[model samples]
Target: MFCFQCEQTAMCSGCTGHAGVCGKTADTAKLQDELTGALIGLARSVDGNANRPTASTDEAMLAGLFTTITNVNFNNQTVQDMIDRILAEKRKLVPDCTTCGSPCSRNDDYDMNKVWNADADIRSLKSLILFGLRGMSAYAYHAMVLGYSDREVNDFFYRALFAVGYDYEMKDLLPLVLETGEANLKCMALLDKANTETYGTPVPTTVPLTVEKGPFIVITGHDLHDLKLLLEQTKGKGIHIYTHGEMLPAHAYPELKKYPHLKGNFGTAWQNQQKEFANIPAPILFTTNCLMPPKASYQDRVFTTEVVSFPNVQHIGEDKDFTPVIEKALELGGYKEDQPFTGINGGHEVTTGFGHGTVLSVADKVVAAVKAGQISHFFLVGGCDGAKPGRNYYTDFVKQTPKDSIILTLACGKYRFNDLDLGTVAGLPRIMDMGQCNDAYSAIQVAVALAQAFGCGVNELPLSFVLSWYEQKAVCILLTLLHLGIKNILLGPSLPAFISPNVLNYLVEHYKIAPISTPEADLKKLLAK
Candidate 1:
C-alpha cells in the first residue's frame, strides 16, 4: 500500500510497507484505496446512466471520501462495507453490466496505483483535485447532518470523481482543482449557516481546561450536532461533557452551552491523544476525522459515530443513540476530585468561538485600535496539527507575535497556544480561536469585512497567514484562499510531497506561497511588508 495525502506521511514522502506512520495497516490502506476507486466507479455509472444521482449516492460518495482521509477510519471491515455499498450503487446504475458478454471498463473501478505512478506534474494536479474533494466532503457531511444540502456541490462530487478516473490533461484537471476549491467554499458557507441557524451564532466564550470530578464524557472531531445530541441525552445523569480536538468550539454556541453539564475542553490537538488519553477515566467519542489508532490502555473507553469506525470499538450508529457511550462514561466515574488540565503552553484555560459574528460585532473597536496604533498587525495562525517535529514553529510563532498584534486562529493548530494567556488588544483576546478548521470560513469572513471597512483589498489589510497543514482539509482550505487571490501565505511543517516542482513554482509565482522559516524571521518579513 502507498499513501501520501497528509503532512506527516512517512519521512515526508509516501507511506508504504506493512503500516503507515499514522498506524494505518497496509490492509486498511489498500481497502481505503479500493473504496475510493469503487466510489469513482459509482460516480462514473451515475453519469453514464444519465440518471439524476440519488441522495444516498451523494452521501455514499461523501462518506467514502471522508473515510479515506488520514486517521479517520482504521477498520478494514468497515471500509470494505463502504466499498460494497458503492459497488452496489454502481451495479444499480448499470444492472445488466454485471453479466454482460461485452463489458467495457469505462465504469469500472480505478486502480489508484496507476495514477500514483503517473508523471509527477499530472499526478500533482489530480492529487490536488482528489485530495481537495476529500476535504470538502467533511464540511458537506457536517452540513447534511443539520439537514442542509447544496445540489451544485453534490453534483460536483461526481464531476470531480469521474475526472479522477478518466485520463485528463493538465488544462482539464487544473480547472477542476480550482472548481473543487469553489465548491468547498460553498460547502463551508453552508456549514457555517447550518451551525449558526441550528445552534445560534457563536460568541466569545472562555472555557477552562479543568474537568470537574465524577462521570464525564470527552468528545473529539467536527460534529456539533452530535455533541448537542450527547449533551441533551447526558443531561441530569451526572455525566459532564468535555469537548476535545475540533469539538472545542461547541462551548460558544448558545443552545449547546446552556447545558451546565457541558464543561470545558479536555486535550490539545488530535496528535497527542494517545498519550493524553492513556490514563483518563472518561469515555471518549469521535464524531469525525483526526482519530488516531487507539492504544490498548484506553481503547475500550473509545466510542465512534458518523463514519468514524475502528475494530471492536463501540460505535454509535445513525440512530444517534449514545446510550453505550454514556454508560461507559458513568462506569469510569472520572477523577475522585476536580482534575485540572491545561493546553500545550501549560495555561489553565483557553478561549474559543471568536467566529465572524463575534469579531464583526466589535469591528469598530478593532478599527479604532488599528488607527490608534494599539494593533499593528494581524496574523492568522491556524491549520491542522500533526506529530512532526518542526510543528513547534507554530508555538513559537504565536509566542513571538508582537504584543500589539492580534492572532486569529482556528482548528486544532490553535491548541499550540490557545491556553497561553496572551491577554487582549482593545478588550479582545490577543489570540482568538475561531471554532473548527472549517471555520476558516469565519476567518475569511472577518478578513473580508476588515478589508471592506478599511477600504482596501484583503491583502492590503495588516494581516498575514501562517498556516500548518496535516491532511486534505488543509488542502481544500489553502485552495480556497488561493481562489480568493490571497497571497504571501506561509505553510509548514512541510509542503506536500505530491506537489511537483512546476506546480510549486506556479504557486510561488502566482500566490506567493512560501514554506515557513524561523518565527522571528518570518515575523520580521511580514511586519516590514
Candidate 2:
C-alpha cells in the first residue's frame, strides 16, 4: 500500500510496505483506498442517474471520505463495510449499470492506484483535491450531525469526487484544488453556524487541567455534538466528563458547559495519547481523527464513534449509547484523589473560547491598540500538533513574539505553549485560544475584521500566520487561506510529501509560502515586513 496524504508520511515521502507511520497496516490502507474509489463511483452514479443522491448516499460518502483520513479508522472490517455501503448506494442509483448489455461504464469505480502512479504534477494536484475533500468531509459530517446541510457543500463533494476519477491535467485540477478550499470555507461556515445556533456562541472560558476524583470520562477529537450526547447520558450518574485534545474548547459553549458534572480538560495533544491515556483510569472516546493506535494497556478502554474505528475497541454506535464507556469509567473508578494535570508547559490551567464572535466584539479596542502602538502585531500560531522533531519551532516562535503582540491560536498545536502564561496585551490575554482546528474559521474572521478596521487587505495588516499541519484538515484550511489570497504563511515542521517539486515551487512563488526556520529568524523576517 502507498499513502502520502499527511504531514508525517514516511521520511517525508509516501508510506509503503507493511504498515504506515500512523500504524495503519497495508490491508487497512488498501481498504481505505477501495472505499475512496467506491465513493468516486458513487459520485459518478449520482451524476449519471436522474434522482439526486439519497440522504444515505450523502452520509456514506461523507463517512467513507472521513474514514480514509490519516489516523481516523484503523479497522479493516469497518473500512470494508463503508466501501460496501458506498457500492450499495451506487447500485441504488444505477441499478442496471451492471445488468445493461450496453453498459456506459461512466459510473465505474476509479482505481486510486492510477492516481498514485500518475505523473508527478498531475498526482500532486489530485492529491490536493482529494485530501482537501477528506478534510472538508469531517467538517461537513459534524454539521450534518447537528441537522445542518448545505446544498452547495454537499454538491461539491460529488463534483470533486468525479473530477478525481477523471483524467485531468494540472491546469484542470488546480482550479478544482482551490475550489475544494472554497467549498471548505462554506462548509466550515455551516459548522460554525450549526455549533453556535445549537450550542450558543462560545465565550471566553478558562478550563482547569485538574481531573476531579470519582468516576470520569475523557472525550477527544472535534465533535461537540458527541460530547453533548455523552454529557447528557453520563449526567446525574456521578460520572464527570473531561475534554481532551480538540474537545478542549467545548468548555466555551454554553450548552455543553452548562452541565454541572462537565469538569476540566485532560491530556495535552493527540500525539501524546499513547503515553497520556496509557495509565488513565477512565474510558477515552475518540469522536474523529488523531487516534494514535491505542496502547495495549488502554486499548480496552478506548471507545470510538462516528468515523473513528479501531479493531477490538468498544465502539459507540450511531444509537449514541455511551453506556459501555460510562460503565468502563465506573469500573476504573478514576484517581483516589483529584489529579492535578497541567499542560505541556506545566501551567495548572489554560484558557480557550476566543472565537470569531468573541474577538470581533472587541474589534474597536484591537484597532485602537494598533493605532496607539500598544500592540506590535498579530500572530496566528496554530494548527495540528505531531510528534515530529521540528515542531518545537511553534513553541519557540510563540515564546519569542513581541510582548505587545497577541497570539491567536487554535487546534491541538497550541498545547505546545498554551500553558506558558504569556500574560496580557491591550488588556487581553497574550495567547488567546481559539476553538478547534475547524475554528481556523475564527482566526480568519478576526484577521479579516482586523484588516477591515485597519483599512487594508488581510495581507497588508500587521499579521503573520505561522502554522503547523499534520493531516488533511490542515490541507483544506491552507487551501482556504490561498483561496482568500492570504499570503506569507510559514508552514512546518515540514511540507507535505505528496506535493511535487513543481507544485511546491508554484506555491512559493504565488503565495509566498515558506517553511519555518529558526523562531528568531522567522520572527525577525516577519516583523521586518
Candidate 3:
C-alpha cells in the first residue's frame, strides 16, 4: 500500500509497506484506493452514458470520496462496501458495458497504481485534483444532509474523476487542479448557506470547558446534522451533550444551543483525543474524521455514524437512532463531580461563532480602526491539527502576534491557542474562532469584505494567511485561495509530500507560497511585506 494524502504521511513521504502513520493498515488503505478507483469508473460511465447523474449517483460519489479521506473510515469492510455500491451504480448507468463484445475499458475501474507510479509532475497535479475532490466531498456531503446540493459541484466531480482516470499530462491536469478549487468554493458556499439557513447564522458565544456532573455525550466531527440529532435524542433524558473538536462551533447555532441540556465543550482538538478520551466517563460519538483508533480502555465507549467507522465500534445508521450511544453514556454516568477542564493554555473557556456574518456586520468599525491606526493587520491562521512535532508553531505564532492585529482562526488547529486571551483590538477579541473547517468560507467572506471596505484587493490589504494543513479539507481550502488569486500565503508546519519539486516551485514562483519559519522571523518578514 502507498498513500500520502495527509500531512502526517510516513517520514514526510508516502506511507508504504504496512500501516500508515494514521494507524490505517495496509489492507484498509488499499481498500480505500479500490473505493476511489470504483468511483472514478462510475464517473467515467456517467460521463459517456445516455443517463445523467441521479440523486443516488451524486450521493455515492460524495460518500465514496468522503470515505477515503484520512481518519474518516478505518474499516476495510465498509470501504469494500462503498466500492461495491459505486460499481453497482456504474452498472446501473451502463449495463451493456460488462457484456459488450467490443468493450472499451473506459467503464472499467481505474488502476490507482498507475497514478501512484506516474511521472512526478503528472502525479503531483493528479494528486492535487484527487485530494481536492475528497476534501470538497466532505463539504458537499454536509450540504446534502441539510437537503442542499449544487449541480455545478456535482458535475465537476465527474469531470475531475474522469481526468484522474485518463492519461492527462501535467499541463492539461494543472487547470483541473484549480478547477477543483473553484468547484469546492461553490460546494462550500452551498454548505454555508445550508448551515446558516437551517441553523440560523452563528453568533458570538463563549463555551465553558467544564463538564457538569451527570450522564453526558461527547460528539466530535464537522457534522451539525448529526450533532442536532444526538442533541434531540438525548434531550430530557438527563443526558447532557458536550461539543468536541469541530463540533465546537455547533454551540453558536440557535437550533442546537436551544437545548437546555446542551452543555459546554470537552477537551481540546482531535489530536489530543487519545489522552483526553482515555478517562472520560462518558461515551463519545464520531460523526466524521479525526477519529483515532480507540484505546482498549475506552473502546466500548466509542460510537460512529455517517462515513466515519472503526472496527467493532457501535454505529448509528441512516435512521439516526443514537440509542446505543445514549445508553453507553447512561451506563457510564459521567464524572462523580463536575470536572473543570481547561484548554491547552489553561483558560477555563474559549469562544467561537465569529463567522462571516458576525465579522462583516462590523465591517465599518474594522475599517475605521484600520484608518485610525488602531489595528495593524489581520492574520487568518486556521487548519486541521495533527500530532506532528512542529504543531506548536501555531500556538507560539498566535502568542507572538502583535496585539494590534486580529487573529482569525478556524478548524481544530485553533485549539493550540484559542484558549489564550489575545486581548481585544478594536473592541473585538483578537482571536476569532470562525466555525469549522468549511467555515474557511466565512474567513474568505470577511477578507473580501475587508478588501472592499479598504478599497484594495485582498492581497493588497493589511492581511496575511498563515495556514497549517493536516488533511484533504485543508487541501481544498488552499486550492480555493489559489483559485481566488490570493497570494503570499505562509503554509506550514510542513509542505505536502505529494507536491513534486516542480509543482512546489510553480506555487512558490507564481503565488509566493512559502514554508513557515520561526514565528518571530515570519512575523518580521510578513510585517516587512
Candidate 4:
C-alpha cells in the first residue's frame, strides 16, 4: 500500500507497508482506490448520458468520494460495497451501453494509476483538484442532509471527476484546478447559508472545557445534522453531549446548543483521540474524518456514522438510531464526579461562533479600530490540527500574538489555543473562532470587507494567514486561497509529499507561499513586512 494523502504521512513522504499512518490497512486503502475509480467511471457515464441521476445515484457519488477521504473510512467491506453501488448507478444511467455493439470506453473504470504516475507536474495539479473535490464533497454531503443542495456544486463534481480521468494538458488541467477552488467557494457559501438558515447564524458563545459527571457522549467529526439528531434522541436521558474535534463548532449553532444537556467541547483535535479517549467512561461518535483506528481499550466505545466507518465498531445507520452508543455510555457509568479539564493553554473555557455573519454584524466597530490603528495586525491561524509535534507552532504563535492584534482561527486547529484567554483588541475578542474548515469562507469574507474598507487589495490589508493542513478539506481551502491570489501565507508543519519540486516552485514564485519556520522567526518576518 502507498498513500500520501495527508500531512502525517510516514516520514513526510508516502505511507508504505501494511498500514498507513492513520492506521488504514492495506486492504482498506486499495478499496478506497477502487471506490475512486468507480466514481470516475460513473462520471464518464454521466458525461455520455446527459440525464440527471436519481436520488440514490446522486447520493452514492457523494458518499463514494467522501469515503475515500483520509481518515473517513477504514472498512474495506464497506468501501467495496460503495463501489458496487456506484457501478449499479452507472448501469442505471447507461443501460444502453451494456447492450450496444460498438466499443465504448465511456463506461469503463479509470485506472487511478494513470493520474498517480503521470508527469510530476500533472500529477501534482490533478491531485490538488481531486483532493479538493473530495473535501468539497464532504461539505456538500452535510448540507445535502439538511435538504440544502446546489445545482452548480453537484454539477461541478461530475465535471471535476471527468477531468481527473481525462488526458488533458497543463493549460486545461490548471484552469479546472483553480475552478475547483472557485466551485468550492460557492459550495462553502451554500453550506454557510444552509447552516445559518437552518440553525441561526452562529453568535459568539463560550464553551466549557469541563466534562460533567454522569453518562456523556463525546461527538466528533464535521456533521452538525448528525449531532442534532443525537441531541434530540438523547434529550431527557442522563446522557450529556460534548462536542469533539470538528463538532466543536456545533456549540456555536443556536439550534443545537439550545439543548441544555449539550455540554462543553471535549478534547483537542482528532489526532489526539488515542490519548484523549482512552479510559474515558463514555461512548464517542464520529460524524466525519480524522478518525484514527481506535485503540483496543476504546474500540467498543467508538461509534461511527455517515461515511466514517471502522471495522468492528458499531455503526449508526441512516435511521439515526443511537441506542447502541447510548447503552454503552450508560454501561460505562462515566466519572463518579465532574472532571474539570483545561485546554492545552490551561484555560478552562473556549469561545467560538465568530463566523462571518457574527463578525460582520460588528463590522463597524472593527473597521473603526482599524482606521484608528488600534488593532495593528490580523492573523488568521487556521486549518486542521494533527498529531505531529511541530503543530505546537500554532499554540506558541497564538500565545505570542500581541494584545492589540486580532487572531482569527477556524477548523480543528483552533483547539490548540482557543482556550487561551487572549483578551480583546479594541472591544473585539483577540482570538475569534470561525466555524469549521469550510468557514474559511467566513474569514475570506471578513478579509475582503476589511480590504474594501481600507481601499486596498486584500493582500494590502493588515492580515496574514498561518495555516496548518491535514486532509483534503485543507487542500481545497488552500487552493481557494491561491485562487484569490492571497500571498505570503505561512503553511506548515510540512509541505505535501505529492507536491513535486516544479509544482512547489510554481507556488512559491507565484503565490509567495512559504513553509513555516519557528514561531518567533515567522512572527518577526510577518511583522517586518
Candidate 5:
C-alpha cells in the first residue's frame, strides 16, 4: 500500500509497506485505494455514457472521495462497502462493459500505484488535481447536507476523477489542477452560503472549556448539520453537548448556541484528541474528518456518522438517530463536579466566531484603526494542525506578531495559540477564530473587503498568510488562494512531497509561495517587506 496524499506521509515521502503514520494499517490503506479506484471507474463510466450525473452519482462521488481523506475512515469493511456501492453505480452506467468480449480499459478501475510511480512532474500535477478534489469533496458534502448542490461542482468531480485515472501529460493535467482550485472556491462559497443561511451568520462568542457536571456528549468534525441533529436529539434528555475540534466554531452560530444544553468546547484540536479523549467519561461523536483512531479506553464510547467510521465504533446511520451516542453519555455520567479545562496556553476560556459577517460589519472601525495606525498589519495564520513537533512554529509565530497587527486564524491549527492572550488591536480582538478551514472563505471575504475599503488589491493590503497544512483540505484551500492571484503566501511544517521541484519552482516564481522558516525570521521578512 502506498499513500502520499497528506503532509504527514512517512519520511516526508509516501507511506508504504505496513501501517501509515496515521495508524492506518496496510489492509485498510489498500482498501482505501481500492475504494478510490472504484470511484474512478464509476466516474469513467458516467463520463463514458455521457449520462447526466444524478444525486446518487454525485453523493457516491463525494462519499468515496471523503472516505479516502486522511484520518476520516479507518474501517476496512466500511470502505469495501463504499467500493461495492460505486461498482453497483458503475454497472448501472455501463451494463454492457462486463459482457464485452474485447473490453476497453477506459472504464476499468485504476491502479493508484501507477500514478504514484509515474514521472515525478506528472505525478505532482495529478496529485494536486486528485487531492484538491478530495478536499473540495468535504466542502461539497457540507453544502449537500444543507440542501444545496451545484451542478458545476458535482460534474467537475467526475471530470477530475477521469483525468486522475488517465495517463495525462502535464499540459493536460495542469489546467484541471487549477480548475480544481477554481471549482473548490465555488464549492466553499456554496457551503458558506448554506451555513450562514441555515444557521445564521456566526457572531463573536466566547466559550468556556469547563465541562459542567452532568452526562455530556462531545461532537467533533466540521459538520454543523450533524451537530444540529445531535443537539436536537439530545435535548430534554439531560445530556450536555460540547463542541470539539472543528466543531469548536459551531458554538458561534446563533442557531446552535441557542440550545441550553449546548455547553462549552471540550478538547483543543483534532491532533490532541487521542490524548484528550483517552480517559474522558463522555462519549464523543465524530461527524466528519480529523478523526484519529480511538484508543482502547475510549474506543467503545466513540460514535461515528456520515463518512467517519472506525472498525468497531458505533455508527449513526442516515436516519440521524443519535440514541446510541446519547445512551453512552448517560451511562458515563461525565465528571462528578464541574470540571475546569484550559486550552494549551492555560487560558480558562477561548473565543470563536468572528467570521466574515462579524468582521466585515466592523469594517469601518478596522479601516479607521489602520488609518490611525492603531492596527499596522493583518496576519491570517491558519490551516490544518498535525502531530509533527515542528507545528509549534505556528504557536511561536502568533506569539511573536506585533501587538499592532491583528491575527485571524481558522482550522485546527489555531488551537496552537487560540488560547493565548494576544490582546486587542485597536478595538478588535487580536486573534479572530474564523471557524474551520472552509471558513477560509470568510477570511477571504474580510481580506477583499479590507482591500476594497483601502482601494487596493488583496496583495497590496497590509496582510500576510502564514499557513500550516496537513491534509487535502489544505491543498484545495491553498489552490483557491493561488487561483485568486494572492501572492507571497508562506506554507509550512514542510512542503508537500508530491510538489516536484518544477511545480514548487513554478509556484515560487509566479506566486512567491515559500516554505516557512523560523517565526522570528519570517516575521522579520514579512514586516520588512
Candidate 6:
C-alpha cells in the first residue's frame, strides 16, 4: 500500500496505511499495481505474438492503463478483473512463442521495481518518460473516442510499454523519454484539431462562477465526449449542466455550449470536491481523474463512466446511458429556487477559453502591444491546482502582477485566480485561459512563435512559466517544455518526492529549475531579472 504517484502524496513522501491522501484504500493501491503488472505482461506477450488485438483486448489495454492513473479508479474488484482480462488477452496474443528455445525478447513483462528502484539518474529519466506517456495516453484515449486516432501515437503506447518492461540502459531510455514528449506534442495537436474541428476554435469566452438556481448537474474530469453525450441526453430536460474541474473548458466549445442547459462551472479543482460536492442537491458525474473520495452526503448521487470508478457509485456503462444520474438529479429535486455559488475568491463567475488558437489568432495585436511597451511582462501561471496551502502563491502571484502584465493560465490551477477580474492590458485580456492541461501545447506554440518573431530564444522572451503540478499529465507537459529547453521554470508547491537528490541536482544545474517562493518575492525576482 505504498504510493507516491501524485503531487499530494502523504507528507510529500509516499502514501501508506489504511488509505491514501486521495482516499484510495490500500486494497485499491495493490489492485492498481497488479493491473500495471498485468499490462506489462500483455506487452511482453505482444512482442512474441504478432497478431492484432481483438476489440476486447484493445479495450482492456486502454482501460487498464488509464485506470491506474492518479485518482481515476478506486475499485479493487474492477482493477483485478481488468488484470485478469489482460492476462487472458496476453495468452491469446502469444500462444506459440512461449516455448521457443531461443530467448526471443520481442515481448516480456517488465518488473516495475526495476525502473522504480534503478539508479536515481536512470529512474528519474525513466519515470519522466513513463509518467509522461501515461498522461499522453489519457489525451490519446479522449481523441480516440471522437474517432480521431493517430497510428504513431497508438503504436508508441505499445513501444513505450515494452520499454517500461525491458532492461534498457539510460542511453536507451533517454531517447524514449524525449520521444514521449514529442509523441505527446503530436497527440495534443490531434486533440486540438479534434476539439477545434468538432467544436470550433475556442474564443475568449467568459464562464460564470455563479451556479444557477434549480436542478443542475456538476460534471467534472477530462472527458468532453462524455460531457457532450450528457449534454445531448439532457437537452430539453429541466436539468442544467455545470462544468466542474477539468470540464470547465467545455463552456468555450461552441458545439457544447450551444445547449441552453449547459450552464457555468460549479467549483474549483478536483481536490476540493470532498467539500464542494457535499450536500449538493444535484447529482454529479465524474468523467475523469482527481476524484477524491466522495462524502456520504453526495456519494449516493455520484455517477462514474469510462475508466473512472468508485466502490458503490452508480456507473454509466458503454451504452453511455445516463438515466441513473438524471433520475438522481430529479430525485434530489435541486433547490427550491436558483442557488448561487461563488469561487474561492468570492467572485460570481470566471472566464475561460483563451486557448492558443484564440490567443495566437490575435497574435498581431499582442505583439503590437508588447512592441509598444503597453504590455510589461507575460506570466504563464498554470498547471494542476492542489489543496496544499502553498497553492495560494498562485493567487497572490497573479494578484500582485503589474497592471501592464498579462497572466496566461491553463488547467485547474487557474481556478485560484480565473475569477479575478484582472481586466484588459493593452487591448488583451490580462488573464488568458488556455484550454485543459493538454492545451499547454498551445502555450508552447505561442512561445515558439513569439521567440521566432522577436529573433531570440524562447528563454529570452519576456515570458515566464510558474507551474504547479499534481498528476502525471503535468509530468509529461513539463518534460515537453524541457525537451524544448525552456528554462528557469518556477515549480511548486513542492518538488516531487520521487525525484532523487542526484536527479534533482541534475535538473537544477541543467534546467535552472527552482521551487516557488512567496508570491511577492517571486514576482519581484522574476521581474527584476
Which is the winner by lDDT between candidate 3 and candidate 4?
3
lDDT of 5 by residue, 1-529 (tens): 7888888899998888888999899999888888888988888887857666679878888989999999999898999999998998888788888999998888899888888889999999989988999999999998998999999889889989999998788888877888888999899999999999999999999999999998999999999999999888988999999999889999889998899998999989898899999998899999999889898989998999999999889999999998888888999999999999999889989999989999989899999999999999899999999988799999999889998999999999999999998788787899999999999999999999998999999999999999999999999999999998999999989999999999999899999999999999999999977
User: lDDT tens digits, residues 138-209, model 4?
Assistant: 988988898988877888899899999999888898888789988889889988988999998898999998
Candidate that scores best on lDDT: 3
Q: Rank by lDDT, descending?
A: 3, 2, 5, 1, 4, 6
The 0-to-1 C-alpha lDDT of every candidate, in the order given, reads: 0.91, 0.92, 0.93, 0.90, 0.91, 0.84
Candidate 4 clashing pairs, residues 3+ apart or interchain: none
Q: Find the number of clashing residue pairs for candidate 3.
A: 0
In model 4, the Cα lDDT at residue 145 comes to 91
Q: In terms of lDDT, which candidate is stronger, 4 or 6?
A: 4
**Residue-pair clashes, model 6:** 6
Clashes of each: 0, 0, 0, 0, 0, 6
Per-residue lDDT over 1-529 for candidate 3, one digit per residue giving the tens place of the 0 to 100 score: 9999999999899899989999999999989988888988898898857799899999999999999999999999989989999998888899788889998787888889999999999999999999999999999999998999998889999989999999878889988888888998899999999999999999999999999998999999999999888877877899989999999999998888899898999999898899999999999999999899999999999999999999999888899989989888989999889989999989999999999999999989999999999999899998989999998999999999998999999999999999998789989899999989999999999999888887889999889999999999999999999999999999989999999999999999999999999999999988887
List model 2 lDDT by residue over 110-193, tens digit each. 899999999999999999999999999999999999999998889899999999999888889999888999999999999999
Off by over 4 Å in 6: 52-59, 97-108
Q: Which pairs clash in model 2?
A: none
Q: Where does candidate 6 clash, by residue pair?
A: 44-107, 44-108, 110-165, 209-349, 213-338, 213-339
Cα lDDT over the full model 3:
0.93
Q: Give the TM-score of candidate 5.
A: 0.98
Clashing pairs in 1: none
Error of 3 at 517 (Å): 0.5
